[model samples]
Target: MTAKPPTPVRRFGSIVGTVLTYVAIWLGLVLLIAGVGIRWFWGRITVRDMMISLQNVDLPAGYTREWQGFYGIVVAPLVIVLILAACHAGHALRVRTRRLGAWDQRPRRQRRRTRALSLGLALILVVTGASVFSSSVGLADFVRASRSTMDIGDYYAAPEVTGSENQRNIVNIYLESGEQTLSDTNLFEKDPYAPLEEQTSDWQSIEDYQQYQGGGWTMAGLVSSQCGIPLKGTIAPWYGGGNTAPPDSIRTYLQGTTCLGDVFKQQGYKNVFMGGARAEFASKDTFLQDHGYDEVKDLDLWKNSGESEKDFRPDWGLSDQRLLDHAKDEIDRLHAESEKTGQPFNLSMLTLDTHEPATAYDYCPVDTESRLISVYQCSMEQVAGYVDYMKDKGYLDDTAVVIQGDHLKHMTSSDSFHEQLDRNDHRSIVNRVWVPGQENKRRLRPGIDQLSMYPTLLEAAGLDIRDHSAGLGVSAFTDAIPGGSAQALGPRGYRELVATDSKDFYTRAWDGEEVHG
Candidate 1:
C-alpha cells in the first residue's frame, strides 16, 4: 500500500502464501494416510488398543475417539469426498477469477511460491516416509517382514471336497483349573450321589475319540490345541509387541479358515454363534456373519441388560444348564427356520459358566481352592451338570458333542503350580472332542493351542478344510509334528510374541536398522 511497490508481485506473494499452506496440508495428509495405515494393522484401532500395539504411543487421561478410521472401508470414502469437494471449489474459484480478469494479473511470483511450497511438502514426505519405515515406526517393519498367506490348493492343504459326509457335533469342554489327576472324581472322573456308580470314573478313559494334553491353561495352551499352531502371542503381562499377531492368529496361527464354521457354511449349513461373551477372537460376530450365521447370543450383552440379574443370574449368566436349555429352545427355533429355508444348522456355543469368579460361595461345602484340583472339581461340576442336562434332553445322541476344555485354570500357569498346589507334572491344558459314542482318539501332545480348535474341529465335524496357511495351527491330531517345536512335552510350544513398547526391545528386534526411503 505504501507506494504500491510492485502491486502485481504483492498479489503474487499472497497467492504464494496460500499455495504453500495447501502444499503443507496436502503433504501432511499424505503422511497421515500412510503413517496411520501402517499402524492400524500393527495395532488394535480402539482408543485403548493403540497403547497395547504401538510402542511409542501413550494415551493420556480421558482420551476417546480423538481419532478414528483404522479400517479401510471407513477411511477411504471420507478421503475421496473431501478431495472432490476441494477440487470442485478450486475449479470454481479459478473460473471466477478468470472471468474477473484476475487470471492475467495473477503473478509468476505466485507460481514460484507454489512451486516452493510443493518442494517443502515433498521434503516433509521424504522425512516422514523414512521415519515411518525406520525403528521409530517398528510396526511397519514387523508387518512387512512376517505377513504370510495360506497354502491353498497345495498337496499339504487339507481336502475340502468330502469333509462333511460324516457328521459329529464336537463339544470341547474346558475346565479351568481342572484337577490335574483323576482322584477328585467329582469334577471330572465321575458323578456320585443318587443310584449312581462307584466313587468316580476316570472321566476320559471310558470314551476317547480324539484328545490331547495341551500345555498350561485356557489361552496359552488352548489356542495351540485348536490350531495345531504354536501358542506364540502376547503373554499375560506383555501383549502384542515382540513377535506375535492376531489377524495372523486368525490366518497363520489358527489356519482356521478351514475351520468348522466355514466348511459348514460352504456346504449349506447355517452358522450360529451362541456364547456368553463378546469374545475377542471368537470372531463371533464376524465369523458368524461371514458364514451366514442366523442366530447369535452374546453373553456380553446379557450381563449389561436391564433385566433382573437374579432371575438369569449364574456367575457368567445363564449357567451351563441354562445355556443347554437355551440351546434346546434355539434348536427348535432353528429347526423351524430350517424347515422354511431348507438349510442345515450349525451352532457354535462358548460356555462361560466354567470360567472363574462363579457365584459359588466361599463358605459353601464345595468352597475350596485348597489345591488346583479341588477348584477344578468345583468348575467341573458346572460342566458335568451341563453335560447331564444335554444327556437328559436327549440331544446327547442327536448332537455330535465336543466336550473339551478351552484352557486350564490359573493353576496351570506356566510351572508355577506350586503356588496353587503342591503338585508338579500336573500342569497341562486338557482338551478332548466327544463324538457321543464314536471312538476316534487323537490327542495333541502337551504344549499345543486352542487356535487349533477351529481347523481340527472342521475335520471332525465333517467339513472340508480350507486354508490353514502360516497358522501355527496345524491339527496336532493330524499335523506333522515339527520336532523341537515345543521340546516341552507336546506337539506345540508357546512363544510370547510381542511388540516393543520399550525403545530397547524395538531396537533389539530391529537390530538398529535405519530407513532412508
Candidate 2:
C-alpha cells in the first residue's frame, strides 16, 4: 500500500536539516580557504594583527594583488555553494516522485555512498576547523599567555622629559620593510641600501636594532618606537565593554599613552607627518593626531593639491621621488617658519616604495634583475637625495635626523626576497641616527630593540629624560641600565614579556585610564 504523505512537521525538519547541512559545508570551505590564504599572503601573523586588519579595511596600494586574491576566496565559496544547491534541488525533485518510505528502500550501495560522502565532508570540516583554530587563531598560545603572571604595566615607566638648551629640530623617516639583512651580499645580489648608507656614513648606527614582538607591522612599529609600548589589541573579548575595534570606531588611538609627538608638542615643537600612502589606511592619521601631531600630509594632500594622477603610483599613492620632493618643500617652509618663530618643528615621513608587491617607478633604473631590489634601490636613492638636500640647506647642523625601518619585510611565498630572507639567521631592523654635532660620535648601547628608540630619539633630539627611561625602554644612548626596565629584562625575558597577552595593561591603555602595577 502507498504510504501517506509525510506530516508538515516532518517536512519542516527535513528542510531544516538540509539547510543546516549546506550551511556547514559553506562555513567549512570558507574556514579552509581563509586559513590557507592568510598563510600564503602574510606567512604567520598575530591574532592581534589579524583582528586589527579586519577592523581597518583600508588597504594600501601594495595590497592590490592581495585584494584580487581575497576576491577569489570570496567567489570560490559561492561557486561551490551554487553547485551544491543544484545537486540538492535535483535530489529533492527525484524524492518528491517517490513515496515517503521509498527513500529508505533505495539501493544499499547508493545509500552507503551518500553516507560516505557525508562522513568525508564532516571529516574535512573537523580537520579544517582544528587547523585554523590552533595555527591561525593561535588558541593554545593565547590561553597560555592569558594565564601568565607577567604584567606589562608593572614594567611601564612614564616619560619624564627635560627640554634641551638647543632644542634641535627633528626629522624622522620610517623606511618600509627595511631589514638590514637585505644588505648582506651573501644573500642578495647587491645591497639596496648602499645609496642611503653612503649618505648616512657619518651617522651613528644601532648595531643590534631588534624588531621586538608586536612591532612586526607599520602601525605597531610606529607606536612601539614612539610611545615606548608594543601595539596590542585593547579589547578583552571575555569582558563586556572592551572591544578592540578599528581606530575609526574609537574616539582616540592610545589616548592613555605619551608619545614622541606629545613630548615634542609639549616642548613647543610643531609636529607634522607626511607619507606616500593614505594616512587613514591603518588609522595612522588618527594615531598621529591623537599623539599631538599638528598636521598630516598624506595621499589625500597630494591628490587635493592638484598633483596629476600620473605622478602617483597605481598601487600605493605616490613615488618616493615625488614624496621626497614635496618633503623638501615642506622642510624648507617649516624651517623658515621655525626661524621666524622660536618654535622648533618635527617633520616625520614614511616611505612606501619598498612595500610588498613592489612596483618600479618611471624614474627607477633597471640595475637589478629583481624588480623588488630595483625598487628598493630607487627608494634609497630618493631618500639619499633628500638627505643631501637637508645637508646642503644646513639643516643637519641643527636638526636631529633619525631614520629606521618600520619593520622587517613580510615575506610571502610569492615575495622575491623570500628564499634569501629565510636563509638568513641574524635579521635586524636598519637604523641610523644623526644628532647635530654628535654625528657618529655618540655610541648607542648594544642589544637594544625598537622599544629603546623612544628614549633614544628623545635623547638624540637634545632632550634629557629622567632615569633614561620611557615606558618600558631605557635610552640606548646611555650605558647605564635602569632597574626594572625593558633593557634590564634581557633579550629573552623582554621578548617573552612583550609576546604575552597583558590584557589588563592594554585595556587600561586603550581606555585612557592610568595603569599602576
Best by lDDT: 2
Which digits, one per residue and each the tens of the lDDT, describe model 1 over residues 267-320?
777766666555445233543453345666766655665534542445345444
Off by over 4 Å in 1: 1-161, 168-239, 242-258, 279-294, 300-307, 311-321, 332-342, 361-378, 411-423, 436-452, 464-517
TM-score of each: 0.47, 0.74
Show model 2 residue runs off by greater than 4 Å: 1-143, 236-249, 515-517
Q: Which candidate leads in TM-score?
A: 2
> For model 2, where is the 10-residue window of minimal lDDT?
236-245
Backbone clash total for model 1 is: 65
Q: Write the per-residue lDDT of candidate 2 for residues 1-517, one digit (tens) a residue.
A: 4334557885686577667667777777777777776665555555655655665455346656457556655778778978988997887678857745254455556655775677578568857855884586555555555567887888888888765786789999999998888898888879999999999998888887988765677887898899888877655412212123254334567777788998898998999999989988767888899899999999988989888777787778887889999999999999999889978999999999999787777788777778888889999999999999999999988889999999888654455676666445588999988998744497888768888899998888788888888878888888998777767876656755786767778877778776543
**Candidate 1 TM-score, C-alpha based:** 0.47
